[model samples]
Target: MPHTLRLTVTALVGLVVLAVVGAQAVSVEPAATPSTVVRTSETTRLPAPDAPNVVVFLTDDMRKDDLGYLPHVRNLLMKRGMTFTEAQSPHPLCCPARAALLSGQYAQNNGVHHNSGAYGGWESFDPSSTIATWAEDAGYATAIHGKHLNHFDADAPADPGWTNFDILLEPATDFENFTFFDGDSFNDDYVTTRLDERTVADIDTWAGRRPFMIFANHVAPHIWFPESAKGDGDGDRGGRLPPAEAAYAHALKGITPRAFKDPAFNEADMRDKESIVSGRPKLAPRPLKRLNLARIRSLLSVDEAVAHTVAALERAGELEETYIVLTSDNGYALGEHRFTGKDRLSDEILDVPLVIRGPGIPAGTRSARTVSLIDLTATLAQLMSLTPTMTIDGEHFVPTLRDPEAVGLRDTMLIQTGAKDPSARFPGWAYRGVLTQRYSYARRINNGPTAGFLYDRRQDPHELANLLSDERYRAVRRELERRYRVLADCSGTACNRDFGPLPRPRPAR
Candidate 1:
């Protein structure tokens, strides 16, 4: 049998055992109150008669600044919502980031460090301790649609907390038609359109009856039907763009930051960095521009889907009672330092956009606070007035939403890549670091020699220069290393304290 199939069988066996034991021990549990609450200026907000509804739209591999291309998102969400300027994906990989968001734990604690390995992806994740489970136990209807994790298959056992589950089995090549299992049956259709329709229908069905949460995951804007994978005689390989979105080709120009194709693209700086960075293709300007445009065109449907969802909520009379959050699982690297995909400890891949509009959140405000995907779990738990039963590596960022000027809950944010094992999908991608407002630092772990990276964000926002070897920044690098060590293994409240407040946002040039 193939390796993936063998693993799936093993995992199913484990899940059956777990389900049997869990069913026996499970009992009705009372909802718990929020563990911590931060004061805000808006104390007069009305309490909800029931739990507030939550709608999360998570896009895959979307660049932070790409939100400009989606007008509906900008006007409806950003103009009427609060934007977190420094939000990041702590672990910029598909499986690991999703796992962290669901479990509120870092890859080290969650045991899903890489996209595929002995301890990676869905099989290793403990589904019983996810945000969906927490919300379901709190008496809120929960559903998840779209991408779940890399390598998920038919044999994968259903997650216990979700009342409705529709997920893509694996990455698809044909963007126009992809297979999805909608709880009861497997069907092939245009994924983006299907997901949008199902989401609105779900809202129509559950509105005014109960508090519900729906996670609409989009796969667009991710690389689809790459040239390398095309015409291999596989039925999956075909055109990536749907016919409706073809008109958007080259709609917007691609952005080339100062670091794009820099002299240091693949130059040997440190021994450890060379193993992963060297020999990679330098991004060609023309091709990179075209690729970036393709990404934007792919998101047009997602933008339309957002508009439809909000309209559906309004029609259902649930718009005022629902919290809408727009974000991405991870950011993509486009010709930044000779890279075009994620899985590196760089700003290009780590920085993601986060916008939220809800009952108590301020409107038309921008926050410079630094936050991460892991915090989503804690934020949802608090929004529904439920305490988590498991220890998590995230803090409630609801205060930031309530008051954009409020001090950030976390002082330092942890950014990481997956394991470096030879069996791992992306070997030598292992690294962990701490990101502050003004600096980004990383050190290779479990592979290669003691390699370290340090960038002064204020001086080089694009990270064109490496200051790790500069004698002037020696003391700064040492201090960052100390903080990274302290946070690398932290969990729960230990990871919630403020290291230091971020500097004010920089003035536009």
Candidate 2:
């Protein structure tokens, strides 16, 4: 059967199944309101005077430096809000990172360690304890418009916490011919434009009601391959620019990051690094650069979407009260270290850009605090003065929002790949690590291999030098390994405690 025909049949069957199951699904009750909630030891602030609105603009496969290409994001968000310089995606994979953001737990606790059809996905994620449900219980209007989880279909009912849900029903590949479940029926349209339109309409409708939490997820900048280009050797599928933004392609043709195809690109060894990283195919530098430019051009549409959404909020009289956050599900590696995509433990894939602008957040501020996507759930819960029923692996970073100079909340961030799920694209290649202010340490898991890595981030930001075998740094490696072992299995509030203080931020050169 044709792909479209299969999808149509699946969607029809799913709709019928959901119609019967939806009525039997239990509704989540709102948790008891707390008068005074203690978030952390150093920071204790009052809840908002009224529930503040939140709008998270989540882009797919966006890197930290890619924000430079987005003017509206810089002016509206970076200039007006706090920019977290050290923000990272805990797991650095699509489904795992998204699940961590919503559940406020690490991949181990959330049970979504990889994308759908591989180990875990929507079926493994526990939707009953998400930020949307908590916000709904707090008497705030909630809606999520755009990409939800990988492989999500009509069989999956809308999250009970959301008053409105418009989610993508197919794999996020084609930019123009994607289908969406708009809380009632599945419709095909241009993905980004449709999402922006739905977001603006929702803001207008909910502006008069209680505070709203809107997640505007965009599908720009992700790789798309035309049917004709999929099996060709031209490599066009990995960097095809969207047709709507063809005009902007020339704007970033010559612009490339300094680290593009740097010294670490495709080192010739596998004994030191994990099989997934060291075994990647090598590509020419020029083609990788071209692909990077194409990726940047695709992001122009996302910038336009951000501007329109902000304008909609302002026109609806909720601009000042709204908290606008811009970030990505995971960072992409464009020919960095000879790797073209994510699923590795490199900084290029783990470090994401996080900007938050809201009522109390200071303007034109920058923070060096080490934070993760998991912390978003706790931050929103505390901001709205609602207590969550489940134990979360994240801590509220409101203190940093109130004070940019505030000390970092977490001493070390636990990073890992998917578990030993044979369904994964790279099965049995799992690894776990810990990232501190100055070092990164990772080792293979499930007895796959004895490969391990240790990088002194302070001296080698690009992670070119591996110090795991160096006798001079043996003590440092041991300490990092000890921390990683303890953190890889941690859960609940124990994962949020400060293991140690992060190094002070260095001034920009």
Best by TM-score: 2
Q: Model 2, which residues run further than 4 Å from truth? A: 1-49, 183-189, 225-250, 261-276, 279-281, 420-429, 447-449, 500-509
Say which candidate scores most in lDDT: 2
lDDT of 1 by residue, 1-509 (tens): 23453344334433432342221111111112211111111122233466899999999888888776666676568877899888889898878888998889988788887776665667778877788777776766777777786546776666767777767665443455456654332234345767777777778777987788888888777666532345322112243532234434433443443334555443333332335564565556775666666776677667767767776787778888889999998887766666767878888789888989888887889998788898877887789886577999887788888888877566777888876366644443478888887899887775443465778888878776666666677677777877888887888888766766433333435
Q: Which 10-residue span in candidate 1 carries the lowest summed lDDT? A: 22-31
Model 2 — which ten-residue stretch has the worst lDDT?
34-43
Model 1: CA > 4 A from native: 1-48, 172-174, 183-189, 225-275, 278-281, 420-429, 447-450, 500-509
RMSD of 1: 14.4
